[model samples]
Target: MAYYKEQFVFDDGKPIPIIIRNYMASDLEGMIELQAKCFPPPFPTDLWWNEKQLQNHVSLFPEGAICVEVEGEIVGSMTGLQVQFDPKNPMHTWEEITDNGYIWNHDPNGNTLYVVDICTSPLYRKLKLGQQMMQAMYQTVVALKLERLVGGGRMPGYHRFADEMTVEQYVQAVVKGDIHDPVVTFLLRCGRMPLALIENYLEDEESHNYALLMEWKNPFHR
Candidate 1:
């Protein structure tokens, strides 16, 4: 994997330059657009940016989210939330509300890191910018001395729907769902393991799909 300063380009006339710049609230417009191009149904525009920063989410990154830019345009991004899921600082409010219940209470001394989202434009596939993003993401985790990092990754194939469909189209529709992304592949490439497979999970109405939880251990998290 390359560092933040490394620049790698593929033969497709596209260059992915890695930079540690923050994903400022100001960059939400570009971020949202890139997110749309990257995902079947990207996050809504309202949550893309906050007039004022919000905590308890990826926006908690003090350095802001990390992004990839190609020719001065946002092409990819990676963001994380800093949380310590100890008896003192639990992962969330309730236990049954999440799958974290299965994770041991090792967080008593371990800080939990949530990889909220890692996205990249389809035009830049196989370019390895996602690996760079994961490498940078680990740097952030190490800097914060986090113990566990968790996030749901799309399965290898999921149903994706089009904007509009005909009767026959809806009956035999081919949703452009993608279950793989650079970040998850990057984590696996970096020795992370797939913890479990979640089925029929959806973050929202438009995002009905399954996901996997990928995790990496860092003894250096201290």
Candidate 2:
């Protein structure tokens, strides 16, 4: 597949070129750097992508691994894999679903595209690079004739309200627009609907180890 490009203009009207494309072996280092910048110290540094995991992504499903580049630097990325997803049994940990980020369990014939991870450089947050990367994944869904795009979205804002409400209540408040969660809200805005609540989805203290199981069904899938 060919790389996609767009230009974003800054406040001074200087347009910077951005390229969104499938992941390449050479981009692994930059992707790792981006993970550090996006996740920071409190987040486990070990969870960052390593050369082996990135190599697995590119080799196993290159189309599902995408990155955004600005002037030849990797700024944002999204990785996913085809999985045999059972909507009725949607309770799975991030590691279990993503095979500990190696995607070794990728099922070519599976009907669902499971988004494993997505991140953008801290400095490039204003560029909406995440949304663009997601849009590219949506395109992948249609092209692959998948049923939907699914992901376990971290509820980073939940810890702040954990004492005030149950996780379910917190999710309801966010869905009802009564509260705003940086991660969940962003996923909702990307056209994904809440499927369920997953507890102990990962080691995210900010999210109280909780996540919102979200999905975006492909409208073109018949």
Candidate 3:
């Protein structure tokens, strides 16, 4: 895919220029650095990405792997693969979905666009770069004629209520609008919904390694 550039207007009436483009070998250092800044230490054991893993993902589905740049610095990125999964039985962890970071399970002809990660630099968080990356992934799904977008939505606020309620209870509360989970709330506002609660999706203390199996069907899809 060719580079896609656009300007987004901020609430302050200032325009921020950004480019959404395919991942390149040269972006490895910036991508890794940006991810580190986005997700700090004291997190999961294998929640980070490496050069080899990125190479594998790019080799498998180059179009699904995309990054966002501002003034030539990689600030945000989202990775995904075409996959075939049953919506009723979507039981999976992050490792299993991306094949333990190897991403060899990518199927180009699959019916679903399985997004793995969508992150943005801390410096650019106020710019809504993460949402932009998601929009880029959605455009990819449309371009590929996929049925929908699927992924694990991390609940950034789940850890606060973990001591008082079970994971299921927390998820149900979020779904019913009783609670506001940062990640889940954002996904919901983007027209996506959680199908199930996934456990051990990662090894993070914030969310207790739990995630939501989120899906967003293509409304324009036939």
Candidate 4:
């Protein structure tokens, strides 16, 4: 596939161009190193996707596994799979959906694009690479004729008030504009609707192991 490109101007007025494209066999090492830099401590090592798991993602959904490159170096990645949107069972934990990134649940004929993970290298965070990756996913969703984008967004800021509020209360607060969560806020800005609060979805102490079940409907889906 051809690389998708976008240009962004920083505070210094210099234009930085980024290329989004499908993951390649040669990008395996860069992807692993970038993944390591994306998560902080207390984020469980066991929950992280290994090379084999990433390989599985690529093998299963080549069109959904995307990488971001700047100046010839891999700086961000977004991985997703196609799955049927079952209205009967709307709520699902991260593990149940992605099978911990082994992607055993992928359905090539499905109408929903279930994004499993989106991360940017630490050095590139200021460049808003994560947001760029999401935009790329949006384009992919439109191209694939998907109906929606579904994923669990980490609530890294929730632990600050964990002693005072349950995950539900916290999510409720965020939904009501009583509080702002970095991840949740960003997802909202990206046009995703927060559907539910998932418990023990990830292994981060800071997030209190909570994640927001977020979905963005594809307007182009017909």
Q: TM-scores of the models, in the given order?
A: 0.62, 0.94, 0.91, 0.89
Q: Judged by lDDT relative to the true structure, which candidate is superior, 1 or 3?
A: 3
| Model 2 quality (TM-score) | 0.94
| lDDT of predicted model 1 | 0.53
lDDT of 4 at 176: 84
Candidate 4: count the clashes: 0
Candidate 2: worst-modelled 10 consecutive residues by lDDT? 2-11
Candidate 1 residue-wise lDDT at 194: 63
RMSD of each: 8.8, 1.6, 2.0, 2.2
Off by over 4 Å in 4: 1-3, 9-11, 40-47
For model 2, what is the C-alpha lDDT against the true structure? 0.90
Weakest ten-residue segment in model 4 by summed lDDT: 2-11
Whole-model lDDT values for every prediction: 0.53, 0.90, 0.83, 0.81
lDDT of 1 by residue, 44-112 (tens): 655442334322222434342678877778788876555454333222322222223222222224366
Model 3 clash tally, residue pairs: 0
For model 4, how does the per-residue alpha-carbon lDDT over 29-116 read when each residue is reduced to its tens digit?
A: 8887776788766666665668888888778888888888888888889999999876556777777888878898899899899988
lDDT of 3 by residue, 1-222 (tens): 644757663646788778888887777888788778888886553567888888887777888888988888998898898889889888988888878867899987799999888888888878887787888888888888889999998888988998899989888898899999888988887778778888888876788998888888887899
Better of 3 and 4 by TM-score: 3
Question: What residue pairs clash in candidate 1, if any at all?
Answer: 155-179, 160-175
Clashes of each: 2, 0, 0, 0
lDDT of 2 by residue, 81-181 (tens): 99989899999999999999999999999999999999999888887888889999999999899999999999989889999899999999999999999
Q: Residue 176, candidate 1: how far off, in angstroms?
A: 25
